[model samples]
Target: MGNSTFVFVVFILVYLGMIFGRLPRLALDRTGIVVLGAIALLASGHASLEGGRSGIDVSTILLLFGFMVISAQFRLGGFYSEVSRRIAGLPVSPGALLGAVILVSGVLSALLTNDVVCLAMTPVLGRGCIRRGLNPLPFFLALACAANIGSALTLIGNPQNMLIGQYLNLSFGGYLVFAALPTAVSLLFLQGIVLLLFRGKFLLPMAAKEEPERPFNAWQTAKGGIILCTVVLLFLFTSLPRDLVALGAAGVLLLSRTMASRRTLDTVDWQLLALFLGLFVVNGAFEAAGGLEIMKDGLSRLGMSLASPSRLYGVTTVLSNLVSNVPAVMLLLPLVRDIPGAGYILAVSSTFAGNLLIVGSIANIIVAGEAERMGIPFDWKGHARVGVPVTLASLATGLACMVLI
Candidate 1:
């Protein structure tokens, strides 16, 4: 078979594995599948090992790794837990509490990684709701939806955004101009939907109970907070590369005397990193073999042009749901690299699309699983009841925002 044909086959298998989240009847996960695909290309003489390694974007990976480390510091320092505990303990009523949840989740997810935000907050939020004798479903649902929406606010908010921003060389400040308004609108939409759907339940009397929480480590929290602020500021105003700024912050956090480097580093999602590396190689091999050009030609014949922001938005929304946002963005990036404002559109649409279904985004999945573990029983039907409406509302608002701005 030709090199292009071999690369194409490998691409198909890797994406299929992504869609299924694993290979059936094999212990191999999505990361393993993609790694195997890259290996397959190398063994078949379709791609050189050195060439495949070069396909990986080191800056994107470093940025992602740095953020994960920063998030880990926050997690271990009890920042996330303390914040949620304070929010839940507020003297406000249930409706206000829900609004608070939405606002906090959205903002934090925008700055921090959304999945880590969801993972850290879900358990505490669930426990708080149960302890207060309030239904946990709406709050948990809001956490997931808001995190997904808020994550669209910045390139560092989620993995796909990071990849798109780094690969397309998008300006962090410029993209935020287009993203902030839509993300705010989406968060408001999500809050309203949850309120309308779960009305009357927020007025329940608070039952006093012991809320299990990590003791707030003031020093560690302060250390992490300072570093995080420095990183964000550097990214915004300085011409310094984001990866270097983030890695520098992570290094500062790692130098803590009280916190063990091992504890902080352990929180890094190495599997996700591996998955990224493997997919980078796989996609690189395909691109090197001219597979992207072939796909572009096929799309052209079908009268589909990804260079158009609107069409790219629609395609990203569909593919994000079909194969999850990170993989979807990776698949689409090579095609729309030069399209004006393509990065911003892809980031917003794909991230918002995660609210369409529980399975659509890793953030949603993390929230759902965490809720279930907390005995909240967050099933698909409950999720879709809120997800579908929120997603549509957000997407409509985001699309309009893109057009207007």
Candidate 2:
């Protein structure tokens, strides 16, 4: 086969691995599969490490890595555990607690990466519910759904948004202007749907057995909080490059006396960063092989070129559900260049689409994994019951906001 054909075969097989979440009997996960694909392209002399670095968008990687470190600081400081305790410690009813879970998870997710928020908060929320004699299922679903919706509130909220914002030159404030209303509305819609669905099932006959989690340290939390806030302000107010700003903030956190850098770095999602790098390399080679152009031509012939924001939105949602959002966004990004308001379309659609299925986003997966480990029965059916309606409502709100903008 020719270069384009070889790239197409490797790309398709790689995405198949992504969909399946592993290789058949190979013990290779999505990142490993992507790394293998990149290596394959390199072996064929169709790509290079330098080309991958360029394709990876070094600034975006830096920004993502910096935030991972900041998130690590919070995780190690036990800030997320404190927040969960405070929420559970309240003298609130089940409905009120549900609303709080939705709102808090959403807002924190809007500020931090949704995956990190879910990873840190899931255990605390789950065990808190156990201690309270409340069934944790609804709350766990709420956390996952709200995190997904909330992550759309800002470009920094999720990886795909970061990639879209950095590569598209989207204004942070401008994107927020478009995203704020929809994300807020999506949170409200999610809260209502979850409350209504789980109203009668919010309690168990008895609280499940609970266990103690990581302890909170006030000084460590305060140190991390200061650095996080500074990073956010700099992102909003200054013209300085965001990657550098975020990286600098992360570096400061590494200087902490109590929390060792090794502990903080341990919380970083190195697998995710590697996944990004591998996708960048493989995707670069695929593009160079004219695969994107070929797909564009094929889509254009189908009257579905990405220049139409609506078509792009629809396609993004479908592909995100099929292969997960990050890979879907990477696949579509090249075609969206110069397309009006494509940034908003990609960000809004891909994010809300994640609520459609458990496997659609990492936040959802994190919550589910935690539930299983805690011996709570969380299944695709339970997730879909909430995910389907929340996803529909979120997409509707996002579409209206996009139209108004």
Candidate 3:
């Protein structure tokens, strides 16, 4: 095979692993495939680590790492546990409890980023549901879906959005203008659809299981909140560069006398960061190998050039489900740089479409993974009972809002 063919083959194989969540008859997972792809490209001279160094966006990585530290503070301080306990403790019916889960998850994701929020909140919420004699599947589904929908509302709410906003140089406040309404409407749709699909199964009893949780610390929680707020405000009002601002906030938080820096640092999702780096290098190789030109022609022939916002939305929704949102978004960003409103197309479609499958987003995977660990039967089938309707309703709501107002 030619150099171009080799790089393209590697890219397809890596993404196939991602689509299936693992390689067939092999132990290689999505992260492993990505890392190997990047290594293969560098080793074969299809891409250069030195020349393609610029392919990796350090600012985006810093921003994601910073927010993760902030989220970790909440997790370690037991803030997430407290919130789940209080919400699940309300003297309300099962429907009311589901609403509470959706509401709290949506708002928290909008602020804290979705993946970490789901990771921190899932077990507590799962245990809370079991304690209340309610089945936890729907609740887990709601948390994952609401987190995805909620995280759609802002530049920092999810990894793909952060990558989109920072790389596109889109205004923090400007992106919110397009996102806020759809987010509100989509959260409502998410609640209704999940409730509808899981109609008779809401109050089924499940055995109680305790997962590891941190003791509550008010000082650490408060400190993390202040840092988060300051970082967000700077993102909104200042042009100090979001990466620098986020890194600064993270730096100051690391200087804590009470919490060990090791513990805080341990909370960061280093694997996700590494995955992003690997994809960047692999994508750079693909583009340099003239794979982009071949793909463009193929897409043009297939009548999905990605210039039209509607077509872009459809492709993004499908591709997001197939490869997960971050990789799908990373692959498409360079293709849409000059397309008007393509940023919104990517942000809304990828975020909302992630709710379509358990493998569609990291938040979904984390929640489902936690469910298995807790001995709960909340797998992809149970998830799809909620995911499919919720995805359709929310995507329609978001796309309409994007087109209309």
Best-fitting candidate, scored by TM-score: 2
> For model 1, which pairs clash?
none
Off by over 4 Å in 1: 51-53, 201-212
Candidate 2 residue spans exceeding 4 A from truth: 51-54
lDDT by residue for model 1 (88-176), tens:
78888888999999999999999999999999888787777776778878898999999999999999999999999899888989988
Candidate ranking (lDDT, best to worst): 2, 3, 1
Q: Per-residue error at 87 for model 2, in Å?
A: 0.8
Error of 1 at 289 (Å): 1.5
Instruction: Kindly list the per-residue Cα lDDT of model 2 for residues 1-405, writing each as its tens digit.
Output: 887788899999999999998888898989999999988988887777763443668888999999999888888878898899888777899889988999999999988899998988988888888778899999999999999999999999999999998889888888888999999999999889988898789887545556777789888888878888888887788888988998998899898766778888888899999999899988888888888888888998999978776677789888999899999999898888778788888999999999999989999999999999988999999999999999989888888887787
Per-model TM-score, in order, reads 0.95, 0.97, 0.96
For model 1, what is the C-alpha lDDT against the true structure? Answer: 0.86
Candidate 3: misplaced stretches above 4 Å? 51-54
Q: Which ten residues in a row have the lowest lDDT in candidate 3?
A: 46-55
lDDT of 3 at 58: 79
Residue pair clashes in candidate 3: none
